[model samples]
Target: MRTWIRGLVLATLLLPAFPACGQGGDGTRPSPSIERPSVPSASRRLTLDEAQAWHGRHPRLLLAADDVAALRARRATQPYDRIAEMLLRRADEHMALAPADVGKAALAGPDPMPHVLQRLAMAGLLTGQRDYSRKAIAMLAALGEQGYPRRDRSVAGAGDLAVGLALAYDWTYEFMTAAEQRTIQRQLAALATEIEASMSPDGGTFGKLAAQEGMAGHHAVALGGGGLGLMALALRGEVNYLQSNAWQTTAEACLRAYYRDAFGSDGAGIEGFELTLRALGAALPCTIAMRRMDGVDLASATALGSVPAWAAYELLPGPSTLPAGESGGGLGSQDAMALMFAACPDNAAHAWLYDVTHGSRGRASFGRAAAGDASFAGPGAGDVMTLLAYPGERADAGPPALPLGKQFPSAGLAYFRSGWGDPAGDAVVAFRCLPRPHLGRWHLDVNQFTFHACGWGWAIDSGPGWEAADGEPTLTPTVGVAAHNLFQMDGREAAAPCGRTLAFVDDKAGWGLVVGDGSHAMGVTTFRRYLAVGKRDGRPRYVVVIDEIDPAPAGQAANGPQNPATAGEPPVHQYRHFLHTGAGNRVDLSGRVATLTTPDGGTGQFAVVSPPEATLKVAEIRTHAMGTHPRIEAQHATAGRFYFVAVLVPRAAGDERPIAVRPEGRPGPAIAFRVTADGVTDRVCVLTTPEARPPNGFGKARHRLQLSRGDLTQSLLFDLEEPGHDAPSAPDSAPGATPTPAP
Candidate 1:
């Protein structure tokens, strides 16, 4: 365990004993004697009834001897750097090592001991190294002498250890001697009991309900909250290296808790993007292991195709949106994980998963022959899993194409795209609207957007809120708010557990709109922002943003920047719109109109079309705090009821004249205007009163909100709040019924 975990454990024990908390009678750490009860390994046995009940479970852990043999045979004939080859190579290398050498090396890592040991045993078996497998069992049994060296038993610490041992025991079952099996069983009993005690209701010196709770006040329960239950399921009726029933009751209860409290029925993850990904890493193995070892599917606990949705949550498009080598972000992608994860039992999301993970290393590594019969010098991550379960060449190719746009309601992630599966000029926007306060690194970017066009992230929001640390982010002190494309009031980033999507709609005309109520996130009385993705003749033409804000209630103090004055000039409220850009970007300014030239010779325009009172300026800004490389910032400030509108259009730099955007006239809470380069015009009319009611008309193209002047005359009743199809914004207009057919 790291020092931090010790510190956290210490914190819980030493912290205040609040009223009726978890752990003990008054929320204090329970006595070790009471917390962990003794369980002897000698008397335990797997009854015939118990064995009969779980009869359907595969006799092998995951891969049987036959599975290993097949892989080895393939290694000899099928030569490649693919999945099968990777596993076979590693297992063969393990065969070459002396048992003592393997044991000595297992203890060398910082503390991936359980992982290392499991690797040792599985690889040894594949290569028929019985002694090597026995060595791993011995070293692991030694760990039981202490209180199981792994800590943080609840989430993953002890859980990881337990899983590793379980895998080792199952995979090396046929090789272990009776004495070795007994020793391993004794170890398993002690470890399993300890893990159960950590989260048990007796509340070790602490309050019964207080062992572990929500970290960020937002989550109901934290990650690995379900790990204990998963461990119990896998360990039941199994000891050290043999199957047995020891903690069946606890396992069943914990599994219930996992579904009830941890992830719930919906397959949404709350602990941010990367951590959720890690949680998936832990979850997939456990679920599959349960199926392979216990005959219990635990299919309900699966994330149900959440991987792709999580990827969509990312603002940038690439192999992975996570910043490479960023400690807090992620380790790396594991293809087998993604493949199996994508191949859920539902098969509803199979095609999509197949498409997304096709090019990934894990996917690419499977079932192929390479240039050489070469093996690895050492074991690799998840090699055993690859050999145990891999898709052959007979799987379906994939679905026809990726969706043009998608909305993951649980993640509050709405994705807008202009034909990503088609041309290279595709555009995408990851618009984040946290339906509730999502406290963590991800929460820092709620109501923020990452825009991509011309094959690159132009407006990027793709890093941790705090790169140097973990947990809740400090927006003002870091590149928190500045890292996203959002509005600034008194210079603080939009607060989390903030904003919710009021409406998300896409038209067949290649236009999409996402409306978010950002009042809570911005710490304001009333705030709503409309995001519009428009296309011209089948290509990404423009992105329009309409922001309406009321900083605070009458008496609340609202602090903001003021326009520079000539000695003694009165202070004026300065509201600003900020944007962070790609690596190579050129900013061209002409009063309120700014043209952004991207590295690939694509140009996008940001013109303030409404609330003409606010002036604008574009600059390539770089600060020691923000970063060394420059980013784009468009500053805006105006008086009266805040109404800001802009058309951000990215297109080929040499294309025809860009669309002209300007306030129509005397724009009200219900009116705005725009004229496209094709001479077609649009009038935006919004009815945003508390008592306002919308006319149910717009079906699919509700997001575009494309209406003519005469259309507005039909009564300001445009209600595009939920799912709809493209009809007409007003029952009388049909100009935008058909999209220009993605240019």
Candidate 2:
């Protein structure tokens, strides 16, 4: 139990975070120290008759016999070449099963090595087999004689059994024996002395990798200190009981200060981009197997090797994803697209998201494989790093300059797309204003927003991956605030959000905008939210929301007009306004306008133009709704001063053109809209005033605010206001933001 690393912290390269001695829970704690027993001694590095006399040599360990003969001379039909034949048929059906009998898989569990026997002992010693390398060296000598089980010892659950028993005892060191490689090095030095007495003084880590508030400890320090620096770089060579440079310089200086306080540098995934692609499926394969076996360049650590093409060009062209906070699904992305093109294979947006979700068979993939730690859901045994760390390139499958608008201003996450990756759904608009003490799994969805067109999804936020459950994990309810969109008062909800984001416009060719204030997480005196997306009669494609609620000064009103000396304050709250659909939507509503119908067969329409005596309701979800599915709710309440607008149009059925919303001039976000379908008369504009500078053809040269079919002018930037959680740790900055931490 050595583990030091104080001087020249691994000769500099990002080290900082992992000092955390102890704090995150739920993984059953119990360790302050004590536990180390193993006895074995013998050596001849790589024996067994030199592994049958270097069998079919060519320095192959993690794929390389010409990279497995160019992946068995590929037949590239794409789906990333059939995920290289489903990772060599999941290491040939995990070397044809038959291993678990070590006291009967340790009587069902207690650290009996379960990541499918480290993918069939590294797919049977990288395909040479030998009884799957002596049954994974007899389950690492029966898990070091059952001593390495404090219930699978945690240090991020012993990073998949210490990186699959340090890659099956360093690629079957010449095929075992020498008392089977010293009985797997005395069970990896007694599981690295129970992970340095269970890390704490700041490194075995805790939580608050907060994206807005809490519950995300940078994927448990990327799978327990990145499986202790990829099992100390496969136990690089020998030494008195081995300590591989003090656990690779103290787990690369606590993952270079937890990738700048939890994976930042604007690649968003601050713990929400689906746990930032499932913690980069254990941080891009321990930062590409410690940069291809020990060069250790964390590719600028938090640059996170172009975060899966920055999550397929700013969070995959819509249609669901941003299950914020505790994250659950979609973007399960084929083991983070084979660990980011096998660690940046010249990346063309990670080979265009491995040609869009690996040749979709309606994406069900062997029925969610075994889910657990999502590296492209099992069955191919959790994407064996897309065929032993894919190097065989596809490089530029073309197209990637990406950005009609991009803003990760330190994970508050903002986006705007009209084209880039456009399959029609290029209008992938988004918003999440994250500010004040909000994250720790906060789904109190402050200034939420989402929209997709052409690429379908009209308006979504009913996140948490349709209530998870396929193989395991059924996490959908990101807790209360009714699965997101915003505004809920009397019934409570926004207890302490913080919300910011005031102006952003990428009106490059048409319109794209974002404006939010969420007035101190909804206590309300003026909680603005103006969202807009373009194209209407050039062929439907539209979205416009402009809620402006103000009612607090001793409030009172069912419809405005009579104040009578601020009469006995206190009873005028009720704000309700959430929008979640997809329980196979078919909604109808009417009076204030609703009209939806998707579930594959499309059609849309939404309306409710202001406090003209507000009204509208659709309701459904809430049997303890954790996230979504079973929602159609529209709601619009009025108890005092008012202003609210909603309009989403995609209307296709027989091209009937007639959409509406009107009430322009003074009321917070004074609104306007007018569409007349094919005959032409589009004038969609969501302009709120009392501005403070911002609105000059939406930034960057030559583009003016007046684009054709209207709908995208955008406004409301009260100097980007953000201060509530009452000093919830100072927020409100826009030129590359980042000042969070308040859950």
| Total clashes for model 2 | 36
Worst 10 residues of 2 by lDDT: 5-14
* Predictions in order: lDDT: 0.45, 0.49
Candidate 1 structure quality by residue, lDDT tens digits, 184-238:
6667776666655654455331112223232221111122323344444444544
Candidate 1's displacement at residue 360, Å, is 6.9
Taking all chains together, each candidate's TM-score versus the true structure is 0.67, 0.34
Model 2 lDDT, residue 581, Cα: 55
